[model samples]
Target: MKQLKFNIDSKIKQLFQYEETKNIFDTYLPGMRSRLESQKGVSSFSLRKVISYSGGAISESAIEKIDQALQNVIVYVDDTEITEYTKQQPLTTASAEMKAEGMYTSIRPGKVWRDTEGKRIQTHGGALYYEDGIYYWYGENKDRTDGNCTVWTWGIRVYRSKDLYNWEDLGLMIEPILDNPNSGLYPEKHVDRPHILKCEKTGKYVCWIKQSGEEACFLILEAECFTGPYQIVKENYRPFDWEVGDFDLIKTEDKKAYLFMDVNHNGIYGFELSDDYQKAEKEISRQYENLHPPFCREAVALFERNKKKYMLTSGMTGYIPNKSDAAYSDSWTEPFQSIGNPHPEDESHSSFNSQISQVFQVPGKKDLYIAIADRWVPDYPIDKRRADLIMRSVASHYEPEKYPMTEEEKREIMDRPMLEDVNTSKADYVWLPLRFEDEKVYIDWSDEWRIEDYE
Candidate 1:
């Protein structure tokens, strides 16, 4: 507990690199930690420089207090003391051990969901695929430092679960082509909303992820088993062209597979897949046509219950919550009836402060469907910017008038560096049960609930 090593001259990012000091900064430094994450070149700037840019918001005395606490801080332990959660690392068949360690027993909405690896489960905008009595949960892996691209994800990460309460990380099923930028799986390209389906006819696992960046399209890959070394069947594949955004895939009881995709800002277009489930046969259904930006919808999650089809969607707001709508139809190809906001009780009608990812029926639980959602940018709430149609949230800009920077100097910060935060591991998940009464759907929020509580 001697005096701190690094002084005020040290780069701010240097302290954040260590978990011990990072916690200290978060506790003592107020808004500095979040500012460093998004604001360009702020992290690399010296501690003193950052405080100056804060325009008297972050005082000098606060820095001295943080430095003193860092001296007496524990070496290894972080502020988030989940020592028991890490007791058994990388567990596969250790459900009993996990429970004994006081880990997962219920689904806690809008909270950090840790995997068996004792790390935050990085499955944002993901889907659940059931096969051989095991459920495979997969989605985008955003575990990287700010890099070259604006909206970047490493690739799709897959995990396995038996009880649906606990997940064991199986690592990346579809790894990106690091050496080749033109490859569909490249790190710069965003491959999100991964919806996987098991083709009973071929007995192969098919994964469909929408890759949007330079060339927006769906990349279809196939593997013999659930944990795949997936072979790309088609890359940059668009069933019919407008442009692709978020998507979902499902195999029906009639032995048919359909892809529910958002065609840019137009509408949610449904495409029926071929027999092998490799390519799109034809466009089947189009729901929720948009007249303008605010009306445009993305994040389309399609599911069927009680012989009827349900489509869940959200507005154009990027990484922020907005009003969610539901549509229903008798047939997959037919037009769906507007059900209005399913979460009417929520004052903002922002889908309980989340965006829908998928809706799947729980095994053996009749009429029970779980709406998997992502509470992206949980720090922010629904506002006028909700319909700005931004694809990503930029870091909070430094205060201008308070800071003593000239207008020319202020403009320079915008060009310092475009920070693309790839570490979306902090993003929380909101999975809630769907309440059905008569053909209409409803989602009621619960802080904590379990599968056993259903039915």
Candidate 2:
């Protein structure tokens, strides 16, 4: 490649043409302009592209610094600029009464979700339960204070919805037991991934939560009502003598409930829940021991389709998003065959820069499932964390051909009324439609969609 000679000052001037781009450079490199202006030589540099350059002949140290600066510049465009621009277009809002009357509502992933009272939805890592014609969502009540902590100090939150779009907060269904130090719900312990199962024999509501602390285990609680002041029925419920991580409760068609958990950070293990869901009866790890790579899975979401059981699990990478894997089998106790990633080719592998929380069947709709995921934002200040910016990196890489949305489709999304809350943190839900072709499953990305679209 032919080299071009230009002073550092000239290059800086060229970058200043775009205001958004200039702002990013300034934010990432405070003294970049002055530092470049002070350099007095006609630098030997070759432009590979408008934004990329090569200075192979330059001093190695100087070249390294320039490379680092360029990388930082790339982060600015990749993360910050795109997210800010997309969110600038405001979403239209509808009246509460209108929404409650069965009006079609839009479901947008990574947008602020609010309840009937207009409070931001606090549920995270939750499960959906359909009972008596209402869908109840139960999840951890994440604290939204300055620290943006994930500890379940307020306990599990419950929200009810006739239609999944608009939810009515039922407050904290299981409050942290502050008075009893021996209680599993004690404030010091981090409680999360709340799964509720209604017993077929006794008609009692059973709740299971992963309690993390000195002795991490699954805590089982029960209540007579769906809206509960559930009491702790069992604590430290350890299956196969392993600490529980992210987990799920799946009730089979045969009325057998099973608890699937990340045991010892290894592959997932299945245990049969007793008739009342109060105790773990048998270890069924032998079935899926070969399905996943050892210690490679967590945050499991299990469901059945076309008479075959399927599971979606995230790699053990803390809060960062990774490619999710899937497995299936004819029987829950039989070995499942790995089907690789269930997402289409896109930025973030069509998982939408999130980890799977749950995969559930839409009420009254056959062969339709929704994959609920958490787009986890760093637990830090907005400016320092750059949660929106990080998401933008993933969003900007989305290939339109892979997930096409026409201008009319875009307008439809913007026109749909949604509740907004300024107090909410950057963490948001990334709910996508789960589609099955033959025995293989895939998740399709939609900007905004309604349940009727599937029907």
User: How many Å off is the CA of 159 in candidate 1?
Assistant: 1.4
Stretches of candidate 1 above 4 Å error? Answer: 1-101, 145-151, 383-423
Model 2 clashing residue pairs (backbone): none
Q: On residues 370-448, what C-alpha lDDT tens digit does candidate 2 reach at each position?
A: 8988766422222212323333322323433534444454333322111111112346788888887889999877789
Q: Give TM per candidate.
A: 0.70, 0.66
**Local accuracy of candidate 1 as per-residue lDDT tens digits, 295-374:** 57888888888789888888765555777889999988777777987887776557777888999788888667999998
Candidates' lDDT values, in order?
Answer: 0.72, 0.64
lDDT of 1 at 450: 88
Instruction: Please provide the root mean square deviation of candidate 2 (C-alpha atoms, Å).
Output: 14.7
